[model samples]
Target: MPPLPPVKASDSRAARLVLLVTAIGLISLNLRPALTSPGPLLSEIMREFGIDTALAGGVTGISLICLGVFGAAAPRLARRFGPERVILALLVVLAAGIALRGTGSFGALIGGMILAGLGIGVIQVLLPGIVKRDFARHAGTMTGLYTMNLCLGAAIGAGLAIPLEQTLGSWRLSLAAWALPALAAAIIWLPQAFVRQSPAPRAARPGRLWRDPLAWAVTCFMGLQSCLAYMMIGLMPLILEQRGDDSARAGLITAIAIAPQALTALAVPHFAARMRNQSAVAIVSIAVSAIGFLGLLFAPPSTALLFAVIEGLGLGATIGIAILFIVLRAPDSHVATDLSGMSQSVGYIIAALGPIVAGLLRDAGGNWVLPAAFFLAVASLNAVAGWYAGRDAHVLQDPES
Candidate 1:
């Protein structure tokens, strides 16, 4: 290993910075399609495998659980292999897993999803640290850009899955198509792997994150918001279908709900950076989401499109706020990594329960009303957690205190 050159502050350097950020953005675009594409194709998958809706939902739950559990291990892996290398390796893993999803066996499909989920989990945890380190002066902008790519990926996956399935003659081919983007990301990221070879690793602070109130606040907010998002992803189409909307219309509604995220995802982090306190924004975002849930639950079928847009706005803003808290609450980059690990690890584990429980409610009583109520409860909690996490204060203990 050797010392790396410093990032020069020059016009040419700025141009290179733009290119590097674009590459990273493309990599972010590969993270979510596999997980989300399944939702739109849930009925096709169930029919093909002769499985129930709960079982289909369980598959998503298992993937999410693996995401959380494996996400905790990412920082350690990054420390060992370097963040760039870990990212490249995970991209390969994601590509292979996604490509294998066309195998059509139930076990193979679940295994593929788990592997893809693990890759996505690791990337999600590591990319923020990479942005923080490489774009220190522009972390907020870079984070927003990367997150926008994530939303774009989700929207594209949700929007195009059915059409691709129709053209390819099976859901398996539609699912496997996501691997191409993952492969492209790997190719683009390869040059970055050795660019900063001897960079000093941040030392780990000795503290129990679970005991920190701010950490718990961020965790709870992340979990609760994710619960709402995943519930919509897994069950919204079915709910819409029950109201006499066809599958295509339901898919389109889901796409609309997610598409506005691309704009809000880019906007929230940048705006939050200018605010002295993010609590107001957080409260408003979650409240908006709660109202969106109510709209879906109680509004007439003709108004579903309007509700989708409202929900999408809230979802987009909540994601941005969650990531903003990661940077705003932590004292330094190392603490950001630790806090991210804690928040996402615990948050996702809690989030993984949403779909499973929603499925159970749907199965037991055959109604979406109870699950809709559950989403509202989660949204209320998200508001409270966001208020605390979005406060203008740090979570790390002051050494002199």
Candidate 2:
């Protein structure tokens, strides 16, 4: 069949597109706050509740596992309903989860985290396909735009949590404050659910994805980079605190370190898209992140800002490239969402292990040395995966070529 005629920019259509893009940015802004906001308040939560590192790590781990499980389920949901509607419902759920998490009960917190993760999981899988479908010609640029917002949202959450607590006289209120953004994003996104969409093709059955090598490469890269991202989210503040910074400063430092990622996330994907292959950029990003990790481990307290800048740039680049691969490697939007679900489901499951394992090592060894060394080794493996994933071929093609 000939493709549908290109969507011309009529007044209403143009307004819709503008709203959609604004909604996308708003949703992207909501994504990271739920995940990163908790990191800053963890010490107070632990101290008040007598929770230990292993248990604290479990909260992050469980949320990641939910992210994986729900991510895998998203394509099916999107195909059965529609991506826009699914996203709208998830946003409400996310807002509710964020609010419920601050109710002062441990069980409530866990339930809230899982609920929030489930919401985030579906959105993560769907956004790439939506971008691919709507902005096919501008996939890389749009991806970078939304992703930059994701980093900015993360930085804001991490940086502000402590200050919010200071002003509000309770960490619970600080955690609940994130719900405001989610609700506002939902209000902006509400218009999308009402727009009629053409029926999507039935999603492929899940089993075949397990057999695809490029899918595996994409999955590995997603998982490995996520390991670094989640590890930092769950532990960076603690790492800083252990080194002599107070909780508030630690959170702020973590925010400053993560801020540079927004710049690289914006620039790298646009430049990388012009290349014949992305392998070099991929490996270099990992190398840069590895160096940053090394500096954070050994550098004096005074150099924290320098280390943060390096680490953020590297992480931002790697993550931006990872998202780009879902679009770049797929043959179409259907394939892109499928590959996204496959990668995120398995990738997040693998990432779920990172924080808990590091916590265990820290508990056992009583120092950060072993955990840092272990993460370096994982980063090395991530470089190898990125190299293969960067090859100039589609997922359906024989990657060996």
Candidate 3:
């Protein structure tokens, strides 16, 4: 390896900054669809495999767990190989995982999901540091953009999976189609990675993130929000189905619930930046999510779309706000990296419980009401955690401070 180039001030005048930010946003967009797309197709997958609902939900939970587990290791990999190269390599892994998932075997499906989850986890953990390093002054805006693209990707995957499955006459083809985007992102990312490589670089010493209380607070917020989001993605369709909605309508409602997130992703961080403290924003976002969950629990099937939109907006805003916390609460780039690792590592592990608990709840009650209530309770906890985490104070070990 060659010595890393020394950090120097560069011109981030408007035009160049826009280009850099756009590149980063596009790369981040490639991370979510594969993980989210499976949810919309859960019914079909269950039928094909002749499995019960709990098992189908477990498969999604397994993928999330893999994401959390693999995300914890991403920083070390980035340090060793460079962040850009790690991203490119992960994209390849993501593409291969998507392709293998279409194998139509239970074992292959589970294995592919694990691989895909790992790829997503690695990308998610590294992107924050990439943004902080590359757009130091404009980290908030860039974080918002990256988050919006992620939500957009999820919306597209959720909205289109059903249609694609129908058009191709098989869910396998629909699932496999996502691999193209991952491959294209890899190809585009390759040149950027090559252009930015340095032979050697400063080695950051690892620290005890587990011992940090603020770190745990941030992690809890991340985990709790993720739990709500994934639970909705995995179980919303079934919830709608039980209400006497047809399969197509259920899928459409799920899409509607996720689609508004793109707007929230863009708006939340921009607005949150104006506030002195993010605690108020976090409180409102989580409250909104709670309201949306209540709507889903009590609203009639005819009004499900309305509830979905409400939930989508809250989910989107919460995601943007969470990313904002990663930027606002960290003292500097290195601290941001540490915060990223801590939040994502523990957060994801916490998130993995959502699908499992929701699945078990459904199996126990044979209905969506309990699951909705469970999500509401989680959202409440998230709000509390976010309140503490959204403070302007820096973590104790934040070097940048």
Candidate 4:
């Protein structure tokens, strides 16, 4: 009959915070696998379904389209049910989508991807606002963490798809394995939905985000960079295979390009947050990314590994900076939700075009050169938009607003 010593309040609070962050990170780990896993397996899936590259690209494009469409719905759902509960529910949906793809039919496969995108898009829109709401002081660092995990998940999917296929003897089984992690994250996040959150401060209404030039700049930066990012994810492995690498080797190379994303994804936001404005960081990231893309396109196939790593570093930094702008520029969680929804909604829709266009270009020219040139133009525009969006000004600062 002994009583345990009472736990300290500060200690308990710290433990809970750590648990919340872990939950958030775990949830972020589910965001990209569905999008990237199918990349390495695209050729196999296309063969099984008797589809062309354009149709293959449509799978990624479909998800991005759903991502855009659902992104706009996230804030509304959050306002009604709270972000935590909505996220938890959507994780189940995501898991179901992942498993549905395992049915080994093209209809189920495409249907599953659309469901997964619905889960991913809303969860993504809501997370920035939660970070801003709960971890406002460390928004940049936390955003870096979020994005780092997101990229890491993508690398895992791209890197392991072929091996998993070999081990399991079917690509369907490999894709279905991701469902386990989605469910695990949902279990870890169970407690968060019940914890009451601090109320967000009432913020002055900015004019419609669509009407704000600063908001548009942020959207453009996010969209264009995401366009480039998705383009590479959708096409890189295929490009390598066409250049003569085997499926496994191509997947490994694609994974190598994505793995380094974690480093810059963590570093860029931390660095940008300390500066007066993020323009230098944003513009520099864009330049490095463009250089890497061009190198991969024009250099000997022998150089793919080196260029892949370079591309990852720059791409990771760009994504981190894009998300950081959303948290930093918005004055409150409410505004952050609205801005996040707007930026990602429009941005991902624009992003969807990248894969489809690249596919069409390849079909027309019988090579990747046209797609490469198109992406170069996209990167050039991303640089300009990032500079404007990176300025140290709030989206609501206009007097008329």
Which model scores highest in TM-score?
Answer: 4
lDDT of 3 at 159: 79
- Which candidate should be chosen as best, given lDDT against the real structure? 4
Q: Each candidate: what lDDT?
A: 0.81, 0.87, 0.80, 0.90
Let me know the TM-score candidate 3 reaches against the reference structure. Answer: 0.92
lDDT, model 2: 0.87
Q: Give the lowest summed-lDDT range of ten residues in model 1.
A: 197-206
TM-score, structure 1 vs. true: 0.94
TM-score of each: 0.94, 0.95, 0.92, 0.97
Clashing pairs in 2: none
Ranking by TM-score: 4, 2, 1, 3
Error of 3 at 378 (Å): 1.0
Model 2 TM-score (2 dp): 0.95
Q: In candidate 2, what are the lDDT values of residues 171-254, reduced to their tens digit?
A: 888988899999999899888888756466456545666788878998999999989888877888888888898998899988
Clashes of each: 0, 0, 4, 0
Per-residue CA lDDT of candidate 1, range 99-144, in tens? 8888879888899988998898888887777676677777678778
259-354 per-residue lDDT for model 3 (tens digits): 888888888888887677888888788787777777876777677888888989999988888887887776666667667877887787888888
